[model samples]
Each structure stands twice: as C-alpha cells, then as structure tokens.
Target: LERIVADVGAAVVVCEAATREKVVAAVPDGAVVVAGDATPASGGEGGFAPMVAPDLAAVIYTSGSTGEPKGVTLTHGNMSFVADSIIESIDMEPSDRILCVLPLYFGYGLYQMLTCVRLGATLVLESGFGAGGRIVQLLEEREITGFAAVPTIYQLLLSLPGIGEHELPHLRCLTNAGAGLPTPVVRAVRSAFPDARLYLMYGQTECQRVCRLDPEEVDEHPDSVGTAIPGTEAWVEDEDGEVAAPGVVGELMVRGPHVMQGYWGNEAATDRKLRPGRWPWERVLATGDLFRADERGYLYFVGRRDDIIKSRGQKVAPREVEDVLHAFPGVRDAAVVGVPDDLLGEAVHAHVSAEPGVELEAKALKRHCAGSLESHMVPKRIVIHAELPRIGSGKIDRRTLAGWSPRG
Candidate 1:
C-alpha cells in the first residue's frame, strides 16, 4: 500500500472507520486524509468543475506477469469509450440490474459501476463470491439481467450444489473478461445459465477491454476471444512488426481512444508500453501478451510473452495446456509453467486441483494430456494440490507456480 501510494503520488487518502488508523500511518506526512465517517463539508460557491476527455479519471494497478504491480493511468475518454462499448455490446438498458462481486479497485469491477451509472441501471454489490450460494440467491431475488466477472467466479458458481435447478430466466447476459474461459467451462456456463448470453472477453489494465466474442460464435470458436470491441482495433503482429498470418502467434496490439494515458509517474515504463503507431502523434499499446488469430480475425490468447515455455525446441503456450487440463473430468483449477531442465531447456510443469471429494493422480492426468496434446505440450511433471494459488484478480499465479520447489 505504501509503495502504491508513493508511486501514484496520492495527495489525499480515503479510508473507512475501521481502517482510518492504518491508512493514516501508511500515507505520507503531508497527505490529507478523509475518513468515510467524516461529516460532509458545506457547499462551496463554485459550481461543477468541468473535466475534459483527456483528464485523468483513475489509476488502477495490476500485478503484471512479472508479479510487480504497476499503476495504469486511465482518462475520461478511455473510460467513456469502454463503458459505451460494453453497454452496446451487452445490450444493457436502464431496467437491467447488474450484479458485481469483483473488487471495485480493479478496472473490471470499477467499470461495472460506471457503466451502470451511464445506463441508469441498478447496481447490486456483493462482498465476494465466497461459497457462491449467496450469489445464486442474489441473482434470482434481485432479478438481475446482467452480470460480469472473471472465469474463476464462474467456476465457483458452476460448482454450487443444485445450481442447475435454480431458475434464472431474467439473467439475460453473463460476461467473462480478465481471462478466457476454457472450452469445457464455456459449455458448462452455457448449460448452467441457458437463458444468459455468454460473452467471452479479453483485456488488461493497460486497456480496459480489447475484444469480446459473440454468444452465437462461442460454440464454434470456443478458443477465440472474438473481434475487437466496437470501434477498437486489435490484431497480432509478428517479431518483424508485420501482421502475423492467421494461426501464427504474435504479440497482441491494441489501438484506439480507450488506450490508457500511460503508467503513473513512470515515463520509461510508459514509453515501453505505448510505442509509436502509424503516425508521429499516434501511440499504440504493445500488450506484451502473445496471441494468435483465426482466418476470420478472431483473437485467441496464447500466453504472456514472458510466460511461454520453450520445451524440446517447441514453444508451449501455458493457456493451451491449461485449457486441456480444464477439460479433464473433476478438474477445478489448473496452472502450468516452465521449470528449468537440462535436456528440454525448460520443461512443462502443471499444478492442478480437483473438485471436492475427487481424487486426481498426476499419472492419470498425464495420460489424459497424452491423448489430447502433443508430446512437447504435455507436462513433464504434474503436481496435485487442494487449490491453485491466485492473484487478486482471481487468475492463477503463474509466477508463484514457476518458482515452486521441484519436489512438490
């Protein structure tokens, strides 16, 4: 918290009654502090202060693949474009009641509220997705029409006992972003919420959302993250800076008004992310995330450029291997990473967890992978765990998995 406060150069800190002491201690000496319980100041003479599109809106930090949190600076234009794009893509209306459990500090959750305000839609907040039974109840009781969350939240929802029997006819749309859901999880989500249109989206803190797959195309292109969100441009570029041919993997690039202003107070990091585009004044984000595209221009996330595992002269995408692991029966969570090896350069290692009461054998999972993936893509070693470690966003902690002891 201190690092973030310093990095972002925060002048004023806000806290609740419970955290006032801790927050006061964390903030710098001159920083002003406001407690949630403090009395409101009387109205001043000045009217509403105007804000331009380019004005800074918020700075949300994300734990990038390196495990270092970087503050992403977003502007009014970026937030507006994203909110409008999402509102249109999901066909959200004023009557829609959106349920959100993701933390508001994160962009995905913060936008849910902004989008609701823009649409005049009712926003229902939940503390978290713990146990998920209460979420199911909230869905039915609130008559929620729209819901958005990461893939892990969806997995927990599906695991709830008697989830299928719960009728959620009013649940019109269910959207997944932050990470792509595996094909089997897609099918399961569709089955569980027959009435909701499942939208598989992909994005990062650098840009709130890059693309979203249509519900109709999900079954056919389960692996795809779909086309770019309305008005945005997303494509894969090879190492030579040329557009990668369909099926060829390259770093994903995003260009549009929705791109962030840059990282807060970090010019070097900002320059690294926002590179020169087509024109002198233009800048485009080099996502540093590797992806491949289908002939139809649908984007499929491979892995982070840093996360790819080179094994036996073959480049293995952890996401591809994870998808296969997700398809295995009783598997609830899976994470794969590259471990040092003498012969393979970097050997593929997977850590997986099973559903409650289900026993998973590393050897059996290896056999399962053998039937579905190439020899090089299969895990050289598999570790079974009660649950895979995750970051705040609920995505698997690949950095932690990569640093694990071999004996485990």
Candidate 2:
C-alpha cells in the first residue's frame, strides 16, 4: 500500500480504523487521510467535474509471482464492459444475492461487488470464507443466491464431512476461477450443490474474464475452460504469430474492450503483452498462458509457457500432472514443476499437501501415477509438504516451489 501510494502520488488515502494509522504514516507529506468508517458531516456544494468512460478508474497490482508486481491501469470503460458482460453471462438479476468470500483487493472479488451494484443485487460481504460450517451457516442465513470462490476454497469445503448432505436451495449458482478446478473437485462441487448451476471460468488480471464453461456442458467438457466470454475474442497463437489448429497448444491471445490499458510505468512489459492486433491501432493481450483448443472451440489450459516442463525432449504441462495428483483420494493440494536434471535438461517434480490424517508415501504415489500418466509425465521426485505456499489470491506459489531444494 505504501509503495502504491508513493508510486501514484495519491493525494488522499481512505482506510478503515484498523489501517488508519498505517495509511497516515504512508501518505505523502501534504496528502490527506480520511477514515473509511467515519460519518460525513453536512457540507456545501460537492459537485465535481464529469468523467468519461475511458478515464482512469483503478490501478490493481499483479500478484508478482513471476517477478515484480506491476500496476495494471484499468479504465472505467474496461470495468464497465467486464461487469456488463459477466452480468449478461451469469444472467444476474436484481433479486440475486451474492456471497463474497474473496478479498476485495483481488479483481475477482472486486468484480463481484461491481456486478451486484450494477444490477442492484444484494452483496453479503464476509472477511473471508471461514470454516465450512460457518460458510454453510451463512449460505442458509443470508439466503445467498450465488457464490463465487477459487479452487482452494472449494477443496476446503469438499474436505468437510457431510458437505454433500447440506441443502442450499437458495444457492442458484456456484462459480470457480483464479485457477482451474480439478475434475474430481468439480464432481464434488456438483454433488454438493446438486441443483445449482456450476460455472468453471478462466481469467487473468490483464483481461478480467477470458472464458467460462457453461453449466450444461461441464460433464462433456469437464477438462475444458470453455469458450470466450461475451464481448471477447480468444485464440491460441503459435510462436510465428499464426493461429494454432485445434489440439495444438500455443500461447492464449485475448482481444476485447475489457482489457487493461497497460502495466503502469512499465512500457517494455506492456509492449510484450499488449501487442498490435489485426488493426494497427488496436492492442490485444498476449497471455503468457499456454492453451489448446478442441474442435468445438473449448480451451484446455496447458500451464504457463515458462512453467512447462521440458523432459525427455517432450514439453509437459504441469496442469496435466497436477490434475492427476488432485484426483488421488487423499491429496488435498498438488503442484508440479521442473527441476535441474543433467540427463533430461529438467525433470518433473511434484509437491503435494495431503488431507489431515492422510499419509501419502512417495513410492505409493509414483505407483498410483504409473497407471494414469505416461512414463515421462510421472514425477521423478515427489515431496510432501504440510501445506504448499500460496499467494494472497490463494494460488499456489509456483515461484517459491520452483526454487525449493530438498532437505539434506
């Protein structure tokens, strides 16, 4: 927060009681500080100049897993387009009440609030998704019509006993993003909320939403991340800048009005991602993620290009191995990475966190993978951790894991 305030040269800072002192200390010498919870007194004329849609709205910083966090500058138009598209895709209504469990600073959580406000829907804000019992209680008490969460939250909920037995008739929809939910977890989610529509979405901070799988197609295209969301065009492009054929993996490209302007104060990074599209003036987002599309246009997220493991002269997607690991009955979380190997260039390595009281042996896990994975796809080394490191957004910290060395 201090760095951001300093970077932007913010004139006023608004924060809650808990962070008021910190905000005051962080603000510039002449900057003003306002308490978020303080009631406003009667004032004179407060009208301000009208702003346009293209005007700057918010500057959200990236999680900086790959490198330094960059400020993503979003325009009012960008947010409005996203909110409207999501509202249309989800069929949001004035009567709908959304349960917000993710942090408001995260784009997913921020958009949830924006979408509800745009539709005049109710938003039940919570500090975070607490225990399964607490969340279940909130669902029943607040009569939540929709619920949004990342994959880890879903895993936690599924770990709880009697989760499938709970009846949440009011929860008309359940949405997942911030990372793909494993197929097994998807099944558990469906079983838990038998009547609600389940949406498996794919997105990034650069583009608010790239695609979303329809509830009806979840069974048939369980592994797919679905087609492009409303008002966006998504495709996979090869290194030569040509569109990839179905079943061929390539970098994902997204072109839409909802895309961010650029990374604030980083022209090189901005130019790398926001490249010229078909039109000379139009800039499209070249997402570093690797993906393959089916003949029907459904996308399968293949890991980040840099994260793809090169072993035995074959490019292996970590997501593919991670998915298999997640399917294991006792595995609660899993991450796959490539480690230094003199022979293979880089060897496949797996790090896992198991469910409480579940003891997973490396040999047994290798034996389990031998059945479903190809010889080269199986992890060469499997290390179990009490809990995998995660970022603020609840994504597994691959960067940290990539640098990890086994205890001597």
Listed in order, each prediction's TM-score against the native is 0.95, 0.94
lDDT of each: 0.88, 0.88
Top TM-score prediction, candidate number: 1
Q: Which stretches of candidate 2 lie over 4 Å from their true place?
A: 21-36, 39-46, 406-408
Model 1 misplaced stretches (Cα beyond 4 Å)? 39-48, 406-408
Residue 90, model 1, lDDT: 73
lDDT per residue as tens, model 2, 1-408: 778888777877777889889888888898777787785443458866698998999988877666667789999999999999999887789999999989888889999999999999999988867576788888899999999999889988888888888778889999998888989888888888889999999988887899999999998887788999998999999878898999998999999998899988889989999988889879999989999998988999988888889999998889999988988889989999999899998999999999978999988888888889999999999999999988888888888898898752
* Tens digit of per-residue lDDT, candidate 1, span 106-131: 78898899999998999999877776
